[model samples]
Target: MKPLRKIIFPAAGLGTRFLPATKASPKEMLTIVDKPLIQYGVEEAIAAGMGEIIMVTGRGKRAIEDHFDISAELEANLKSAGKSALYKEVSRVARMAEVIYLRQKEALGLGHAVLCARHWVSDEPFGVSLADELIIHEKPAMQQLREVYDQTGCSVIGLIQVPASEVSKYGIVDYTTEEGGLLRLTDMVEKPGMDEAPSDMAMVGRYIFTPRLMQLLKAVQPGKGGEIQLTDAIAVLAKEEPVYGVLLEGQRFDAGNPEGFLLANAVIGLQHAEYGESLRKSLQEYL
Candidate 1:
């Protein structure tokens, strides 16, 4: 397993739950503190030594591309207006990596969204991160998985210990073995009920996969909600090669859901400079 040089971000979802805000904007453009959700994922990929980033975007997602590319007018206006901090934020994203954009023509499941990037990923192993699922820590989530892949020469995932009652909300793993904190995966089930779940470990935002996983993705038919399931692809790859999970040493927040989004803002806001004191003080009054 060479370095995880390429990463794929699936950002094609219509974000129906977040509309009418999402009606004009891609949900990935929603900010956590000062940064958009997609930038956070892109930074994680860069931190993990990923060289190429492939974003599978869709309609109304041009803003996603523009957010990362060089913005002449915005940069000029900021410079003239003396908005140094805003300039820094926009400029930083522009230089992150070699970002490639591909449009997913239709709203597909997570697995199908990933398949849209097969050409960009080509024959090499790639990383995957969903912007909706934000993992906050000093180190990025994909960086942890890359370290695991470095040592084991196997596919790695960032796993979290979810409550048994909530196993139905995520893809749970069957823990086969554990060498320290990393668990070797034997099986993966998507959205299993509490009683049916093999383990409490849930697949979160980060993943490192072998090129063979692409083959699995191509072969896997759609499951559950008529969209190809990423879990199903990984399950096939598990039988052919070892796939392991690393318990991410960080907090996980899902921004896709309403409650989770507010929680993310609160959690990140508590630590941010631009809004921390004000946000905390304001929220404290309510509490």
Candidate 2:
């Protein structure tokens, strides 16, 4: 298997849920404490050994690109102020990895957004990380999927067990577990009703996909929302070939919504060095 060197992030969502806040800003650029959501995902990809990042972006998302690029004036100002630590921190973001952007002209579904990167990804195995899902773990969650891909030589997805009551909120999968929480998925169901859900293991936002999966994505017809769902393509791929899922060892936050976003901020804020103590104290008063 070719080493997984490329990672694609589908970031073109309109963020209608966030309205005015996201009307002008890409949701991926929303900050969790001090770092943007996309930054966390990009940092996770780099930690997992991926060398290249391909972002599927849309209109009003230019800020995402600028965030990852060098800000020469800001760097110079920091250096002149003798804030070496701050200067290095800001400068390191641009130099983290090779970042490339692709425009998704329309607000198509996730599958279409990912398909936009097919030409750049070519015929190699690649990883996908969704910018809005923040997973906190000892090892990067995408790295866990990479480990499963390396061992099985098949497409692997990050899985997390959700309450059966919540199955309607995510793409559910049916699988048999191998040692170490690895699942051999027999089937996948997208946002099924609670009664129709095949299993409790829901597909999280991390994936390591084969080149053929891209072809499958292209063939997927639009489903419920008149948009092609990635889950539909994955369901087809499972029937045609071996696809596995691994229960990610992490605390995942659905940072795409308001409640989850606040929870994510609290969790990450508690870990922040400079503000952790102050934030914790402030939070305790509210509790």
Candidate 3:
């Protein structure tokens, strides 16, 4: 409630799935097309009227900080080259919002990453977005969850129906009732097995949680991977308060892995206004 001014981004992962590329650079910095994966999430949050950005980072993630900071040299060089449009775009990114970075110190888990921002959030409802999950929609995904949070005055997590075989890969939700795209969650389990899975509706990376959820996260012990799981905390929250699962309407890309990353680039690239036509023609010829 309190107008959802702050959102947290958990960008501390080592990104081992990307191998040598991620060895030096962060997986979040991997570009979808022209912009980095993280930038898309930041732009979406800004579009949803959340101006305060709390980035939870870890060791070897200074690039994430520098990416969002003002670059005087780059801007000056672009201006001198008479690239006014490019200069404005770079300048706009730096001035997008008030960004606050918190070092996670260790690779705990999503729950721990979000818990690190509790002090900054300070008793207000906030949002959590995993940068690797690239969602393309007419209405920003965060805005959609915010709308639900506003109406229910409760925590809301974005949901997507995955295949039964892939259910073990995500936190599956069991709903007590459904109204159109919205479901009132009864229970949720993290990475449940196919046979034990409550439902095929899996939790995505978008979340708008109440301050109380922070308290619940603190109480959660490490689950399967010895990491404090956010789903574990959300399950407790559901038991005490009303938690809603919203089936997000969008094109989602799990750009954390190589295949997904390449797919995201190709798909999103073909939709870019200036480059889409050229890229489409190029792909057609190549194929």
Candidate 4:
């Protein structure tokens, strides 16, 4: 088991859920507070000691690359304006990690997006975090998965117990609980209906994958919507090896959708330094 050294962010989705707003810009570039969604995932990866950030991007996603690149003009302008703090902040984004971008070319699906990064990930274990999902925890969520990987050397997926009625909204897991809170996943179904759902423990976007998982992805045929779903690959992988889903100890937000995006803003905004207090007071008055 090699130490996880890389993280892959699948950022090529069309973001149709966001409509015109995401037409020109990527959903990942939408800001939660002051930082873009992708930046949060990058920061989380860095915090977990994963320095290489491989972004599986697509067309119209150049904004993500630009956001992390050195903005010489903007940096100089901020310096000339005597905004030293702002200059330092802007400069840090470019230096966050060794970011490598690979174009997905086509919007196949999450599993396909991960497959595109096969060259970069090579033969080592890696982490995958969807730019849209934000997990607020004491330790970075991926770090938690890395710990599990350390102990079991098994593939780990982050799980959140959603309401039974909402099972169809996500990939639900069927599992057997181990001594720890870890669930040894026996099966997984993508977006199963309420009656078809195996369990309410929905798979969130964070995952730690062994190299062998890529083989499963390659063998998996297109699923619903004619897209290669990552969940389908994971389900097959579970049959031959142990696939563990850890109940993440934190708040998870599906920031990919407009509703979830707004909720993220409100929740994270309440903790913002410049506006949190004022925002809280205003919300109190408005409510």
Candidate 5:
């Protein structure tokens, strides 16, 4: 298949889970250690060799746009003051990729949010990474998926095995093994109970999808909670084109929930260069 050259990020969620803190800022803008959640995703896409970064953003999400834009005033101030490190950090963001934003006016589901970026991506295959799912692997998650997409010429989604008891929290896929560690998806059940789940393979962030997904999204009538889900759309697409699930070889953190956020913060915080040593020295005390 042709190289997957674009990545679409769906950032239109209200971030109701983070509430008061997110009232002013999008939840994806919440910082992990230093950079915001969305920046981690941007870095992942850049690492995967993506060209255009199209964001399906919503209203009041200007800060997300500003984060990637070249801040001339900020750069000049830093330069005049000899803050080279700070200036370089700010400048690197603008060079990540050609970032283009599309406003998803409604708080529609993930499928609809992705549909908003169709105009920018046209008929090209693209990658999609959730701004909230923080994959903390040394190897960027999207890069891993990109390799599979490049090799297989099939749509791929990152997977992580959740605990049997926690399977109900995500979209679970039932698949038949087609090759080593790769699955040919048979079906998808959203939030199925632990006992009802096909396997512990929970579909998480990071996806490489074809343009056919747009047509599938349009075909699927709204399902759970009256919104279109990307999982459902993909499942339908699987019936035709080949769709595979790659169990992402990494640690992933979901910052959408309080406990997950704290856990993710603690894990990533300990790895920060400025804080690694201190964090390791003191982590046990908190535990």
Candidate 6:
């Protein structure tokens, strides 16, 4: 098995939930505390030992590119102002990794976005991270899945046990067996009804997929809303080969929506070293 040195970030969605804010900006560029959501995802991938970033972006997402690029003029200004700390931080972001951009060209779906990266990811197992789903943990969530892929030489997806009432909101996993805390997935169902859900282990957005999955994704037909679904390809992959799901030990925030986005800001804000105490005091006074 090849080392997982590359990861794909699907950032093509229009972010309809954010309304006017997203109307002019990419949702992945929205800040949680001080860092944009996509930066956190990129940092997580780097911490996991992945050095190459393949971003599947679309129109109106130029800010995402600019964020990772070096701003020579801004850096010079910061240096002249004696803001060395801020200057170094900005320079660090530009050198984070070799980020390659690919245009999805359409608001197709997650599968289509991943498919757009096939040329760059050719013949190598790659990781996929949805920036909107932020997973906070001591160990990078992508690294956790990569460890499983290292052991089994198969695909691994991050899982979070959701409540029964929320099973309809995610792709629930059907497993044949559980060993050492990893579920051997037999199949996956997208947003199944309460009674039809196979398990509470909902698939989170982090995934380490074998190159075979790329082929599977190519054959996937468009599902609901005429969009190709990644879950559909994963379901087929489960039947053909071993695919595992590991319950991620972390706090996950679905920053794709307003409620979760606000909660993430508050929760992560309270954990920020520089502003935690002051923010905590302010929250107490406001509440």
Identify the candidate with maximal lDDT. Answer: 6
lDDT of candidate 3?
A: 0.92
Q: What is the TM-score of each candidate against the true structure?
A: 0.95, 0.96, 0.97, 0.96, 0.95, 0.98
What residue runs in model 4 are displaced by over 4 Å at the alpha carbon? none
Pitting candidate 1 against candidate 3, the one with the higher TM-score is: 3
- Per-structure clash totals for the candidates: 0, 0, 0, 0, 0, 0
lDDT of each: 0.88, 0.91, 0.92, 0.91, 0.86, 0.94
Query: For candidate 6, what is the lDDT?
Result: 0.94
* Decreasing lDDT order of the candidates: 6, 3, 2, 4, 1, 5
Name the 10 consecutive residues with the lowest summed lDDT in model 2.
175-184
Report per-prediction Cα RMSD to one decimal: 1.5, 1.3, 1.2, 1.3, 1.6, 1.0
After superposition of all CA atoms, the RMSD between model 6 and the true structure is: 1.0
Candidate 4, residue 285: the lDDT equals: 88
lDDT per residue, candidate 5, 16-86, as tens digits? 88889889999889988788999988888888898689988888799999999999999999999999999
Evaluate candidate 3 by giving its C-alpha RMSD to the native, one decimal: 1.2
Model 2 residue 29 CA deviation in Å: 0.8
Q: What is the lDDT of residue 259 in candidate 5?
A: 77
Off by over 4 Å in 3: 178-181
- Tens digits of per-residue lDDT for model 4, 1-287: 68788999998888999988998999899999899999889999998888999999888899999999999999999999999999999999988899999999987888999999998998998899997999888898988887888899999998998998899989999999888667899999999989999988999999998998888898889998899999999998899899998888877788988888999999989988898999999999889
Give the Cα-based TM-score of candidate 1 against the true structure: 0.95
**Candidate 2 error regions (>4 Å):** 178-181
lDDT of 6 by residue, 229-285 (tens): 999999999989999988898899999999999999999999999999999999899
